[model samples]
Target chain A: MTSSPEIAMPAADPKDPYAMPALMPSSADRAIRSFDYADFDIPTRKQEDFRYTPVERVEEFFQPFASSDDVTATVGMIDGSALPDTVTVRTASKEETGVPAVGEPADRIEAIEWAAAPSELVIDIRADTPTPVLVDVSGHGLDLAALHIVIVARPHVRADVVIEHTGSARLAEGVEVTAMQGSELSVTSVQEWNDDSKHVGGHRLRIGAEATLRHSVVTLGGDVVRLRMDQDFDGPHAKSDMLGIYFVGAGKHYEHRTMVVHNHPECMSRVIYKGALSGEHAHSTWVGNALIEPTAPGTDSYELNRNLVLTKGAIADSEPNLEIENGNIVGAGHASSVGRFDEEQLFYMESRGVPERQARKLVVHGFFKELVDQVGIPQIDDRIMATLDARLDESVAAPIAEKADDGTANNNENYAHNQEEN
Target chain B: MSTLEIKDLRASVETKEGRKQILNGVNLTIESNTTHAIMGPNGSGKSTLAYTLAGHPKYQVDGGEVLLDGQNLLEMTPDERARAGLFLAMQYPVEVPGVSMTNFLRTAVTAVQGKAPSIRTWTKELSEAMERLRMDPKFAQRSVNEGFSGGEKKRAEVLQLELLRPKFAILDETDSGLDVDALRIVSEGVNRAKENTGMGIMMVTHYTRILKYIKPDVVHVFAHGQVVETGGPELADVLEEEGYDKYLPEGTTESALA
Candidate 1:
């Protein structure tokens, strides 16, 4: 093998344009050599799934790096006491009967090596068993380090994978989850990175016969984060639900792209995503594509993307597409909207004595509750609210609070209705 | 006693043919603890009067002043008017998705009360109010006005009236889209509020159906955007029998009844 370059790129200045950390050669050696980065190049336009999202600009920030000791200390932040004692990484050829079988943890989750020893990962969901697992990945100063994790819900089995990312710097995660025949899976990933962290991750999944898969991503923190999720319903009676929610601030770029396919008859897929952006330069993108194969008779699918832009410079782009080639389909449709808070609704609440902050919070909270409630986890629901509250405080909260000192925030009524419609 | 007074009220709404005046020089006064009925034909601006009083944005008040307890009601926003004890039982309530009835009612109650209602206290109060209306408690969990049948939507309006405890309420055709049973239940709910709170009620309607349940002390005949006649409850009987034709000019079917 050619000697790897050890030169490090300049680290991002905390004050100026948020920059990604440099990558080390060791990390580059781990990725699939056959998969060229340019092959998955984000397009400017005309690209079906990347239509609304600015993935190409985001990709310019990515670099390769090796797993560092920074991850060791970061894992301590996660409460892994409830986690299984033994773990093993199960790939296609490394199948072991007794061990839990998973397609593979995405590279993001697998990158977390324990104490210099490679992580012992295992996907042990057995047929007829219904249980969920939490895989936590934490890091510090890892610079554009990448993590990949793969999960497999065996036939007739059920599982859930909860991924929690807490770290700093530029990080990219790749996750692949597969549900086999008659199986079920729910994967929830939460990115609670700091304002300095930049994250670009992709969730790739496939569901089999009579199987169901649900993927939920809650992004409350991150400077620049882009998420690409692709789901394939491969067997009859299979169903998939993809849901996402994000709150972005000024100078933050949050992009989300989703691609779903109903490849077989009697298969159904639904996608719902909602986001809120505030501050002077907050930008967010939402792209949702649902494809129903011509041979896939009786396919049913629905997709909707809703955005709430809270400020003038805050931008949102939504693109929803449906490719229907079959005549025997039950239904196939898509809806997209990029809007601001509803002013009448806001004034309605405010006139009722809810303060400006509380009123905006209620409207935004209500905006996301529809999709958050779909997760069916009350604890996570509460956690999501708390995270949203904190993020709102982090970006817009400061201005609101600062203005409260001068009693100028009360004039928000003027902007209340003005910002309701984009 | 405090009163809700409309002085020379003139309003119009935008239409394809430009602005059309709906309420022209309308005037009325409602005292606290008394019920007033404004009877009119199909196009007599009855609903427009309610919407104007409630501060709906679509109805522009070209001229007039609305006063609540001698305060300028025209100066307040809709919610502010609501907080100041003016409630409008909308002819068609809006369906707000993702906002549960329980939450909306609780918030409105808190706003009207000018402070947060204790959860425990509000729960008991809500249960009592729902029971009085004979409404299933589960209705509170559904989104406000969403997927509700016409009767259910009307009942929900009355439910808000009870919870909000506004001093003055304009019931805009509360009986318009209800069965006999739903009409009775809704009127009973309003009756209870009147008896318990002594709140002033302004019933605006085309048919005389709801007056039977909640009798009006005074009835005004609305024609050509103005209160052309005012009398005791007997006027409602007279209008019901005459069908507004005797008071209307010939070849003016659109403007006279409207």
Candidate 2:
């Protein structure tokens, strides 16, 4: 547990070094990505951010007029609060554009999003109240699309949000979250894109004085997806808890890079992410970086990443980095591990008369159980489990025991691809 | 009578010191519906026999033939042998995390019996078996042998023996780590298994205490990895009073407890 600071909160500085910088379009990103989207060099493998990802894949979404002509993503409230919706969740108005979340786009593709998207959407939850919001994006066919969302949780309020992406489309999106003082906010972002969908997004959350934020990212289905989660502490005693769970199947790539910047005194952060990969050419990468600034005294933060490999061909590259600029800080640590399924566990099951294949499936199922349960949403958790089971079934899809015409064999093909729409 | 014959059985284990011969040219026969008590001192290969018969990967059988009815037990995998009606109550039962006892037993019963047990009948059978073994009903849903006490592990082993209903059951030190009350309860489960299913049992123990609860038709005194003495039920009483010193070689360091 992170303790609250006993010292008084630092007064707002007249010349706040961390204050908003006045600049050209180069100012805000999560949208800052490409002030010069025109000259934004196609990031090669040399770029640290695009090294693990196939850098060439961004060309499809970079073309102008990428917004879907027919498909319209909608936002719905599922929590049944009956609070009679207050803020404007979404509007097609082109004139409703607002401020971008934070600093300039840290990567090239994010710069592409600024050059693409058609309409601008800003979601503002009235200060000092609780609200639940869900973002549903459904795509059809091959087309370029972009979404930019800015969410503000005013002081003393709690906000819970869920963002889901599905269907076939190339998506470049940016999300910025402003958590005001004494506010509590939790956002669960799920990416269940189709087999051909490609997506990349920059999600940045900035915490205010004495505020807390809980952020979770779950990536299950996608051809190529990368999510960069960036967190900044604006005032003292702000805390952040981050969690993630992902599964990558054959011919798919998923990468999650997260950074927690502790710039205020007495701020704390913790991150835990677990992922699994299966099938040939399955690839997943996780990078966690924690940096404590010089003036940030009494700061404590730690991050951990674990990858479970189910098949020989699958690959997971994990890197956890911790940089404490201020030695006066309390503590900072990070850990990353990649492991294969335990063969001894399988043998124990087989010794009890379970066939080898079934035993293997059981061991993998148990491997992901604890993390899946932590996602906290029963509906989404069940879907993720079903998807994971379908993914594992592909490896053992070979016929068992010569059962002919076996409707069971077809049932084992892995997925129904039930596209959820309401 | 159904005979499970062991002919010229020879086995060795890979110890840190290299392959050490444990069961060398030992032979025994078990007929259905009878209990055979095999008493041996420590390091006499009693536990090795149980593991070898159950197809554990550790012990290597150099030259042997174990025949159950007309099938060869030595040729079958552990799971195959289990499906062919063999049960081993291990000295140290393994812990299988995330596999509940109810699920594990149900799967084994389905594989062995070639069909899933009816739900109501399985529930009744499982509850009755647990009650007879004095195990809490909650234990049925717990991961197999995980976090169980010594006595609880022993009872769980007996519970499997009752439900699996194998043709030949090997009780390997089932009496070892158990209190008197637990010993009686476990023995009662074994007795019920024999009475209801007519299953043959090979009871291996260093003490004669288990024999007091579940009477044996015959008792064999084991020494040097082979049976050196055999007699009727009275032999157990004799060994309990006199020990196995007469059967062991002179200057043998192992205590003659059997």
Candidate 3:
């Protein structure tokens, strides 16, 4: 299968300085067409939403849509290296059938599996089980990649899943997840890719009735990252909480878009997205849309988007849309904001003997703690924190490396380490 | 050198017109293994004195020297002061969302100790501290001060003081908002720390209920940003019985306490 050419359209147009391209449809009734990378579309300054995140840069760095199995293999290879160390590896052959290493969630657990497009992995967690699972995938140079997962919790099961990105430095991936009825699933996805990767991944979750799902995503890497999460509530009385926190550095562009559909009556959904942008040319985009149908009465939904601009040259965009056709629902609302770190909090932390960088780290960590804490699994939580630490290191390290190139490299390492100490 | 010594600490707050004096000219010294009670009516600069010692920016110390033992407390940043064995239990502790009390305490303890304690030791210490304060262990996992009752907040401050083991602590109105039972529990936690360590303490309060549990060796009555009267525990009883009316300036009246 090939992506539609329209997918390649530049998010911004160079020739049209005044006009922006129209946004992709916001309604559920809109057509779903194949996306191709070859046909590039660009947005113009005229568009308020795309004013900050120019898709043109993505077009310049990436090639026009081309069917390259190399890219797919690249992504597949990424999955191989970063697979959860403790996953229940069930190979199709009998030799691979020993208990698929589903380590205890509260303990050390990592899961990663690769299968044919039609294959599925089942993770059955028992009731009241607070296990943590870590999953990893990387498609550094792959073109098209797709992975499917089916998590089955016998009634009243609860567990946490942590997914990490390592080698898949630049590739597109499609992921699918389905949770059975009465299962509580908490999933945390941490993306810490190299600056060279152009990453695109989609996560679709189909939740069963009376099941609870908590999803937290942390994005801190990749040059061009476009991630979309779609959640559908099929069972009545089911609840879902989705949180996303992202930090973008200079010359980096990241986008996180989400669509949640409340299909059943008396269902609930909450989405919180926070981002920080720094550096001279960092860019971030967030588009959130929630659809509440007429039949799904008594549904409660809330969406909030908050952004912090760490530097003047940085850019941030936020778009939140709530479309409710009928008035029978209990409550539905959405809020969005873009701001910088509270100077008061920063000054307070700084005055406390926390050097500037350490204070910044603390504030940023506190910002994301909202989502990170939802992942009930300690193993996943620890890994996510480690990823954040690495990204912060990378952010501070890259500049030092550049300075070192201009001077002495040894001194550069010391300077970088010293800066981190600050 | 005492745990804390303040020399001519003059501080003020900025207003729309100009700077308004908060602490006119105050001087105090507290030795280790002793507790000093600084009691006064509202707005008498009791809290200001605590915040100034902790290096709060709002209260500019126009003239003063705050020394923690021999080191210049004013020269050290708030955190440096903390690491050097200074602690302040605020009258209103700030709510830090998403950061658990356990995580916060662990980091603070490690920072103060210059190394991380073993998880076994740390967790045991945490449980014991919580038990001493009569706090639910679940509170350790909750966001700092988020959704906590008034009494819970006060207890948390004492819990932190126990875990951090600072050489000197300023409990700013720790008894202001607590019920009788809460006050007793908090006082017991503080008393235990006092018994275990040679740390000195400056307790700022308007009420005398807590004094019954944690006896103070000295009492200073603060008025007009200065220690108007320094006496023994008897001063607390007299202030509660007679009120500060007789001490007020000529033009001031009862409502001036506001």
List TM-score per model, in order: 0.79, 0.75, 0.72
Candidate 2 docks at the CAPRI level of acceptable
Who is ahead in DockQ, 1 or 3? 1
Worst 10 residues of 2 chain A by lDDT: A413-422
The model with the greater DockQ, 2 or 3, is: 2
Model 2, B132-195: lDDT tens per residue? Answer: 8878999988887889999999898888888888899999989888888988888888999999
Each candidate's DockQ score against the native complex? 0.27, 0.39, 0.21
Per-residue lDDT tens digits of candidate 2, residues A1-422? 55468966444444663453222111112223444566556667786666787766655654455666433466767565544455556553434445435555666666667556666566767644444677777777666778777777778777777788888878888777878788888778888888888888788789988998888898988899888988888799998988898888877899999988888999989888988777767889888877776768888888888777666566787877665666676678766777765544554555566666776666666667666776555646787788778877875673332212222111221112111111
The best candidate by TM-score is: 1
Error of 3 at B17 (Å): 3.9
Better of 2 and 3 by TM-score: 2
Q: Between which residue pairs do clashes occur in model 2?
A: A28-A32, A29-A32, A32-A104, A32-A105, A33-A105, A33-A111, A34-A111
Q: Which digits, one per residue and each the tens of the lDDT, describe model 3 over residues B70-139? A: 7988887677888888888887777766667787777777777888899998999899889878899999
Error of 1 at A258 (Å): 1.8
Fnat of each prediction, in sequence: 0.29, 0.31, 0.27
TM-score of 1: 0.79
Interface RMSD of each candidate, angstroms, one decimal = 3.1, 2.2, 3.1
- CAPRI-style grade of the A/B interface in model 3: incorrect
Clash count, candidate 2: 7
Model 3 residue A398 CA deviation in Å: 11
Per-residue lDDT tens digits for candidate 3, residues A1-422, read 67688687545454663365233333555523233322222334454334444556543223323223333221111223443322343313312422232211110000111211223344445445433554556554644333444444445666666666765444444444555678877767777777777665566676778988887778878777877677887688888888998888888888887878888888899888888777767878888878887667878888877776655566677777677755777777777766665544544444333444665566667777656666455555666676666666655454422211221111111101010000
Against the native chain B, each candidate's TM-score is 0.95, 0.96, 0.95
